[model samples]
Target: MIEPDSSGDRPSGSAPETTGRFIVVFAETEADPPAFLRSAAGLSNVADSRDFGHGPVDPATAGDADATVFASLGVAVVTADPQQAGALRMSSDQSNIESISPELVHHALSQGTLSPPSALFQDTEHFTWGLQATGAATSPRTGKGIRLAVLDTGFDSSHSDFAGRQVTVESFIPGEDPQDGHGHGTHCIGTSCGPRSSREGPGYGVASEADIYAGKVLSNSGSGSDGGIIAGIEWALVNGCAVISMSLGADIAQVHPPYTAIGRRVLDQGSLIIAAAGNNADRRQNDFGFVGAPANSPFILAVGALDEQLDLAYFSARTLPVRGGQVDIAGPGYRVHSSWLMPDRYNTISGTSMATPHVAGIAALWAEATGYRGRELWSVLVQESSRLQAPSVDVGSGLAMAPQE
Candidate 1:
């Protein structure tokens, strides 16, 4: 493992302070890392970060070449700003994509770029749940102002409802800015704390007033590595986030090792984590079984998915590690409506990914009321969940309708 540079003196604090320096990796760029980082902005440290193989891999390097960068800089922990992440769209999704005008694109694109209104993101249904007289009881505490860290694709800062809200965007994929390329992240956030957008029951949001932290760990394609996720979780844990909505997952046996340590760290640091049980409902496994992992992390509240009809999705993974202490809750997942890539459209995409946010949105309400710590927030939510009558494997808690809606 690459070690932290013993040569540099870091400020002596229990926590590692984030340095302004950030590394950018891509198939392009032949310039030296030191020059690139210094040119991007005034950074104190920089190094040749990871080589994803797709990039220019200089074969002539010495021993301990690329991997040593992060362990040394200590700045390995640095974050990607909006100006740094600029979004990367899929090729077909790129043909029509072009540099936007108004000069603002300079700032928005350098880190992450939004699709031109006609590109692809069509805003869909609003995903908030804290309407006073809606699904849950009209309680005084339903997450009015707590902050939640959304670690997925970035959000639609251009959306009107998000107006006046404070958002800090970061990226893991180089050249990927905060502008969400895939509508998945937008939908996920809309479910958690989106504000009133349109009428027809599409404008009202859940936990509408809470602050949001945009941690873009997944790419616009709705995929990310366990390493990137771990790093993103670290950012959320130390950045004043009370609740974290991670609407994605990998199988119990498929995930990388770093995931175990990072998942545990996020929880130990007092952050409530909500993750999807995965959409891989086995074609072979009998019905009533939908447990998946990392989501199965005991400290994490693993959420299962149910369709619009209130029935579980066929593709939703069957719950396992059940007797072994895995799986936790279930929520509405199929055809759920939320934000999209287009500036004006919104749509409901199916998956346990959709279900995970409902729990997160609900956690926001709990935090607003009890000021519950991460663990406490999750505890209250689980205690109030509506479970399946038979205690089957597919639907963990049967149904997860928050008390406060």
Candidate 2:
């Protein structure tokens, strides 16, 4: 495990945080990945996903294994020395190995600063501003049969409002349980899958009836590496989650290779992965930051933040000129209200992080309403979105909306 670093700052041209380990992506035609690894790189202490039967891979139990292969994703997180990494790269030309890249460290993309807009939609006795802005307030579809996964800093399993909901929890962070220590995950859950009828506050969640799959990919300190994140993604895929929401990313302008492959594979498997465009922008100062890391992957849908007036959030990233760095959609994110830890009960924060779940939840509603998965779901979202005065580079197709019928 690396040291706790809460300050999410990586200078423009600086190298990103990496684990020194490498991720290996195998081609679909690879007959025996483990055997190939053994022959090519002489790696033996490998744990295969098939060993777990129907359950998810336990990172703790497989600690001793040098390489843990996720069968569903055709990916492996391998720990190797310089010699082994070089050998694997050389073998990729003749072997089924497609790409080898260093594993990156990712952090939760929550905004550090808060600035609520003065005018437009506000929370009422019935619904939060997010719901009103996205038309989730009147959407008949409740994501009834959809399985939505929130891969973040765990979740508050005991959160009161979600008592009777069908919530399945898992922790990819080795030492931690599924319970959320950082409130980001819980707040996101409240927005994406919290109950429709609340005991205290307005209905903050969008897909109130969607089954919740809380995967603790990030640790309690709100940081994690690519290995754990990949494990969580594999778990969600194995369990047939149609929509996966990631509110975390690394502050790298270049498109991360692993996420690019992962996003394409996830979409191919009939799932959609929605991620937050990093809160690195300060538009007030004309410092429009570009989308970063996983969100910059071409296959994954990147989301930007919008205030109540449907204006772009100051901290929301502007699109990069690169292929997949553009914001594909927008969501209510400024000073959004949602569930928090116990005693506090609720909290309102702002970020592209908050915007992600809004799109994810609304994706669930659309998934339930149209029976669409993967790319089809992505198309419907862009097609059904409400166009705004904001440029396409910033807001993409505009604010994503829930299926109203």
Candidate 3:
């Protein structure tokens, strides 16, 4: 069920407007989107609109027989003249046209200091201490049949480690290929769905055998608009991905309506969306920043970062329930090592970004082990987590753990 935005009028503290002049309009689940969109006086076709499996509805017949065509989908991205953006918002009834939010920019959550790979232990087959802490090392489940989607900068498809693996790549960022030019996506993917072994060392992946859906939402510059990320989410859902991992976000105090809707929709569809809790905290100085947008939506699982000693990372944001953002769990993030784009092959980075994929990969393992999906899967993750001494606001239920065989 779509919850009403409790803040009444759209808050100014929500996601910043995108540089691009466009607004995403979401229709009611029972409304005829084509007809409704066509009725909007200023609505225009966005260049290169692809049919995302709803069988393209004709604008002419949208009000008639095809009125209900987009009823089930409940979402649409439309472009309007910049001068008419406000009028478009005013026209929405907050029902059939549920929301009209400006597409906002999202960035990779890897803004922390890079550390030497040696900072992480190398004794295990997987260089990441996260994999071991989450029990992925000994868990019987390999996430063989599960499909996990990672929406980020993209992946290093040419990497030898993932050669011959089942990877489906797509780029929502215009003029960019689904390849990891910025290296952030590759490292995140390496942690969540990478292989079991590589020439560099033991495989640092979690759901090693899981099918990978690498969606390039962010660009080479490591930033993306909310439109691209939403498109990627739609693609992942349409493709039947069991878990969608987002290691990217924007720091917004108010919960974005689109994400709240999307998160609820995904949960209803039996898939889980996990996102980073943001890396804005400086605990040493008593600065525990708030979680970011998307993750700020209560429906999405927000993950925080923990160090090797199980202490909250200095940069891991804490949950502020009053602000509607809360951490759901924690994962090893400090000085974590994982796959990087070739030539470099591997890198050690730290952030809530790194911790998110650990939960995602572990979620895949739990899904494979228990056959749980959606909200049930989410509960399993929380219920089965290894409790830590940390506060719930900082580390959620506890450290996210892999399901035991």
Question: What TM-score, over all chains together, does every model reach?
Answer: 0.62, 0.71, 0.69
lDDT scores in order:
0.60, 0.90, 0.80
Candidate 3 residues lying further than 4 Å off, grouped into runs, are: 1-127
lDDT of 1 at 40: 44
State the local distance difference test value for candidate 1: 0.60
TM-score of 3: 0.69
Give the per-residue lDDT digits (tens) of candidate 3, residues 73-104: 46554444544455546556545566655445
Query: Quick one: ranking by TM-score, best first?
Result: 2, 3, 1
lDDT of 3 at 286: 97
Give the higher-lDDT candidate: 2 or 3: 2
The 10-residue segment of model 3 with minimum total lDDT is 1-10
Off by over 4 Å in 1: 1-142, 252-257, 282-290, 322-325, 390-392
Displacement of residue 275 (Cα, Å) in model 1 is 0.3
**For residue 150, what is the lDDT in candidate 3?**
97
